[model samples]
Target: MLYTAYRKYITFFLILFIRLAAFSQGNAGGNTVQTVEIEPGKSINFKATSTPGSAYQWFKDGNPISGATSPTLNVSEPGEYKVLAQNNLNCTSEISDGFIVTVKTSVLVKQANLSVEKKSETKATSINDPYEYLITVKNSGPDPATEVIIKDILPEGLIFKNMTMALQGKFDYNAAARTLTWTIDKLNSADMSELRFVTEAVNPGSVVNTATVSATEADPDLSDNSSTDTKSITDLTIPNVFTPNGDGVNDRFEIKNLEFYKENEISIINRWGNSVYEKKDYQNLWDGTGLDEGTYFFVLKVKNATGTWQAYKGYITLLRSKTAQ
Candidate 1:
């Protein structure tokens, strides 16, 4: 009876030991399974609790990951992960809880094509005239563009005044630098935006204004990325009739808006095509002196900012009182 009782006790202890060993291997070290979601081109970190002088091994879907012996794992793929720690004595701890990392599919393309167009209704403008330039930016893309930047540096002879109400994004103009900058947070595919730049003509010449566009995405076509608009500036008005009778009103052969040009020449001729008077740098002081004028022809030539002379030929009727000395 004593031998049988001892054998029964040994059998009970063996069963208990087997259960304990299984429990230790499957127990989670104060960790719970967590689901992590990440987008494409992104990564997530899986960190395990650390113990002094301990080595770690990480597993993905029950398979041991090569070289994954650190306390932390940077995961970029979709998988179920778990980690186990082994102390200096080579005593392995329980497997930690699983981490399920899932990746989200990308919905947009990586590259986008952008273009810009600049235009003005006033192709020909005069000095002190207010005009507007419309700058349009388009996204012909397979994806949305972010952080769109548009830059337009105004050429000389154009003065920035202000911009009209913008449809998308914001704009700023630096008068000192003559630069206009527009910024948009996002521009979707097949989308377009516009900016109206109001300005004034301050000088004379052919003005070429260009606008360029860029974005965070890569543009396939750079040829259409920039657009240019050209405008001509001229300010002069000739009078058909003038009274040189010294009446303090229309007393001299004065031309409207002629003082703006410093370099000019004027020549007057009679009905017989004989030169009656000629002067360089004419100051509107000619009173048709030494000639009784009824009607005459005049040729006026003025030099522009480009040093090109522009000529104006027309008939001028000079009226002098019959009793004038």
Candidate 2:
């Protein structure tokens, strides 16, 4: 009977020892999982081992997790993640080291350059708005970029009054689309140095129209600014109409909105094709008051925009009427 009791005791002890060992190890205790990637809509798995009867708890911050009984969890923002294991026998394990979960902006801007050409800069066009600017960009990376977008941010809701892009020659513009695109091979190291573009700010605001470019890609965050600057362009246009009325409503019989025209002239002729009045670079009108009434044929003679002298002959009928007695 004594020998039998001793054997029974040894057997019981062995069983207890095995149970303890298993509990101490926990099912996935020692195995380590590295390189957990936490993307926007993705989850990461941490394979840990512990006893089959052990309880699992996962934590986002320092607080205890409720239903996080699993070893994996999907995270979206930047924060700490950890897991803890507890055995049924009241044994506990240390919290796993915290892993960082981070989310990044998908799009990136890249290879942006700003070039300025000064007018009056010798052979650089000569004027107050002496500088001309151009913008260029590329997707010089391993990933294919999609949703490629470019924005010219100007202050006060000002749009690009004058803007252009440069191809080897020039690409046709679809003004309705507001989109400029071309099928380009992978931009690897093939910097789009040959690419050039132009745009001007609208008003005299504190800032110029700055450009920011981006696209959707595998690693969009890698896209970023190449360079930035502020430059000016010729902001000019011809007026709509030239008033020859004396009341100043349209009093000037000069070239309407001709400020941009470097060379100009105006001439008033008589009824018999005889030159009565002439003025070069004239910016005003002829009231036809101090003169006699009847059919006076006026000729607009100028070395027109095409560098050719053209005569626009028309009759200015002065009907002896109105305030000028």
Candidate 3:
């Protein structure tokens, strides 16, 4: 009878031990359902809670995934996934709540081709003369462009006066930096816009103005992104007659627009080819002082900072009396 009682006690303890072990395994590691989103060409990694000396098994949609026994799984396709963990003593945990992955549609990029052209209304200009420049931006593409920007910086010897008009955008000019910027919200395919920029000539030389265009879309061609316009400037107006009779009107041997050329030399010769008067860096102040009333020859040489001296020979008839002969 004692032997039978001992055997019953052993069976009761065995059942209790099995129940405790099963409870411990259920609380070891598990998680709720998670949702993951990815693009068409993108992927995501699925991870499971890891325990020491534990093996893993993954399932997709209530089916066991073949050869997917790692703690982390690299998932590229959309599906519902679940994982289970087994300890060293062969105790298996409950299946996890798992994950729900959804693939998102891919978005295509916009492609566009932008070009710019700059041209001056006049090829030649004089100092302090106002001129106009036409800047055009064109877009040729299968898609529209956004946030279009055009930049045109005036070079030295040119001063920005103002913009005549802008077809489809706003322009801002910084006088101190000589920069003109235009911004457009959107530009449709096969469409074009223009800007008429007016400027004044400050110095005498070749003024090259370059304008460039850009947009928020991918550009296939870059060859026509920028355009350059060049202009030649000069101002040397010489007079043939002058009266140095102390009168305020026409009193000096003044050369119109000669002040624009800072480096210049002038010399006056008599009918006998004798040098009567000469001056360097002339300020148009020659009044034929201490000279007789007769016809004389004058030679004027002027040059800019980047050029050699250019000579202009002419005849000057000096008249001091109130009336001519």
Candidate 4:
């Protein structure tokens, strides 16, 4: 009986010892993560060591990503990303240290320049005219650029009339079909990003139009810093016709575009070499009353449209009604 009791006790002790070992291990079994990384398209995965029954959780920008309770995360966009893994035995593993994974976009315009022409500004050459100003914008990057947004600020007497490419402007703006558009797919490095627009100088004077052309990429991280340029609107044109009918509107008989003429001299003389009207301004006119109710000889001394100063002779007829007395 004593021998039998001793054997039973020994068996019980061994069983207890085995159970204890397993219990301790189950509670403190090292459940720790090894590595974490982001794959293409913002996907994430992690490897770890320890208890079974995998529990996966992903985080982005300090917010728990839903449905990411696995060892891998398949994301679509870009943001701060991380992951956590645990085992089924209620033993949690240490989180993997956060690593940043960013998807970048291609570059748009690389070189910048300005041009002067008739009616427009452009980045490339299509139709060069002395009657228009063309400001050239060239993109020397390898990446295919997205739709580009161009905002051109105009100067006094200079108004943007038309654009060769698709574009929009303030006041007369179209938000849907706005600015120059380049696909965001893939812009090769040696590609050109350009926009050419036309302008007309109203009422003649000195005009300087400043502008900034920016090439935009679709990606947020690599798309904010855009390209820029500055240009001037210089087209020296002279007015072709003027009327002096004494109607109080354009009543002055003088050169139209005399502002940019540098130096202008006008001489109106009678038949006896008597100067009746003479001035260097655009607002000077002779009513033809100094010679009486008859024909009077006149001469004009001024510069021609080609910047040549010379003399031109003409005649003026004055009629006096008897009812004037």
Candidate 5:
């Protein structure tokens, strides 16, 4: 009876030991899966929880990855990754959750260039004369550029006339700030667009137009994004000396290109500041008939369509010829 009881006790202890060993191997903690992103030509490392005397087998998309039996796996592609853990006793744990690795593409703005040119009706521009501006934009990108926009800041001493574009886009102009805007659709790689507008020089000076181009991407180089062009308005020349003797050759003190300035005021002042001749609209028909041969100061002020005025002052000489009847 004693021998039988001892054998039963040994058998019970052996069963308990076997059950505990199985439980310990199966109860191994699992690793928390995570998602990772890597750049092109790069790889990401995934490591599972290390357990002594345990072996690992990495799988991808439910298929075992050959020779990936270590506790760590290096992958580059974008797909689901998982690993199985097993102990010496052949007790295996459930495969860990999938850790996704995504490969990211690099997209950036390769190039952005803005160019402008001016075309005028005459070689020398005068006040109130229209000048045509040609604006061109190009994108030499390796990727598509979306929502491309171009902005132009129209300078003072000029008025906006009209705008046109060769490409499909939306145009907007602000008279108060004298700004023009164009918004375009997606611009593919090596694509180009053209825009044109007309403006009139209202005053005599240098007028500068500045423009810029941009898109919804990383503009690595911004040096070519903006461009500037300038146009100069010729100075109004008045005959310093005119012999208004009715000869029809020098019979009038004519101001060249005065007809272009419709909204203008002219005044002739004597040496003592006494106004001699004054007119709201001077038609370049000033003939020295009533005034004597003397020196005079002339003041000319012109207003633009936006109701802005510019003034010019200079000296004039009126003389009578001896051949006058």
Candidate 6:
């Protein structure tokens, strides 16, 4: 009986020692993570060495990342990432040292650059003239851009007419704000989106339009985000003098940029206030036929489909040389 009791005690002590050794090994060391740096759109995987039967919860910048319960972590954004491991025995280990990831600009893979540019179909415009503006967005990228948005601010000297585009996206114009906005879900690398809008040149001067572009991803270059276009304006250009001597050089009194206006009423009055000539839609066809050559007063009434009419009165000189054709 004494021999059997001693044997039982030895067995118990041996089991205790084994259990203690396993427990000590379970919590022996802390996790070690090396810092990493990667180019944009690149990911870095983190590895850890720690106790057995441990659970892991990953964090980014001290915020717990949901559904991240693995020994390895894949990180793309630049920030401080860490993991918390807890064993099944209910003993929690200290949070592992963080992995500081730096997302540097890519040299081989050119970073995304979203740019916008505007162009007018007509080089110059005049009041009451309708013209179209082509706004283009080009993406110079080794990476794609998502949630792209474009804002086009129209100048005050223009009246918005209409807009059109081929890309599948939501586009809107706020007349009160004089702003046009476009929202695209995604823009792939080397892709371009062209949108066109028509506007009437309202008041004269220099009409300037600007377009701005942005994306959800980080853009290495922002200098191309915005672009501008300027169009010269002339309300009306009428010659003050003309020599209608049949020389065909200065034979007719014509108005520049008058073809843009379809509706017009022109009247010519002599020095004695006599109505010498009058016509509708004057085609620059006046050759001073049967009219005395001298200084004359003229009145021009121009009308546009937009329900706008402007009147211009000025002095015009009609000189006829002594040698007539």
Question: Which candidate has the top score in lDDT?
Answer: 3
- How big is the positional error of residue 109 in model 6, measured in Å on the Cα after superposition? 12
- Report lDDT per candidate: 0.77, 0.44, 0.77, 0.42, 0.70, 0.74
Candidate 6 residue-wise lDDT, 1-325, digit = tens:
7545443343333223222332222222234444567887888666553434257778898999999987667778988786665556554445655557888875554356899888876533457777788888888977888888999878776888987554656889999998899888888899988888788887876788788999877788898899888775667777778888877787898888789888998999998889989999989888888888789888888885566776667778888884544
Model 1 Cα lDDT, one tens digit per residue, 61-140: 99999999987778899998876766565656556557688899777547779999999864334567677889989999
Q: 185-264 in candidate 4: lDDT tens per residue?
A: 22334444344555555543335444343444433232323333333222322222233444555333443334654565
What is the Cα-based lDDT of residue 250 in candidate 5?
76
How many residue pairs clash in each candidate at the backbone level? Answer: 0, 21, 0, 29, 0, 0
Alpha carbon lDDT at 310, candidate 1: 75
Best by TM-score: 3
Model 6 TM-score relative to the real fold: 0.44
Better-scoring candidate (lDDT), 3 or 4:
3
Q: By summed lDDT, which 10 consecutive residues of candidate 3 come out lowest?
A: 21-30
Ranking by lDDT: 3, 1, 6, 5, 2, 4
TM-score of 5: 0.43
Angstrom error of the Cα, residue 8, model 6: value is: 48
> Which stretches in model 5 have alpha-carbon errors above 4 Å?
1-43, 49-57, 61-63, 78-130, 137-150, 161-173, 181-196, 202-205, 213-225, 233-325
Better of 3 and 6 by lDDT: 3
Which window of 10 residues has the lowest lDDT sum in candidate 5?
Answer: 18-27
Which digits, one per residue and each the tens of the lDDT, describe model 5 over residues 1-325? 7545443443333223222332222222234445567898898676665342268788888899999998667788888787666657554545665666788978743453332233333234557766678777777756667788888888777899997545667889989988898888877777777778888887877787778888877676687788877675745655667888766787787888677779898999999999998899888888866888888888888775568776666678888865736
**Any runs in candidate 6 off by more than 4 Å, and if so which?**
1-111, 237-253, 256-325
* lDDT by residue for model 3 (1-325), tens: 7545443343333223222332222222224355668888788765555343268788888899999997667788889877676656555555665567889977788987999999987433557868799999999988998999999988887888888989998899988898999999999999999999888887866788789999999999999999998776667656678998876878899988788778899999999999999999999898988999999988888886668876667688999877555
List RMSD in Å for every model shown: 13.5, 17.7, 13.1, 17.9, 13.7, 15.7
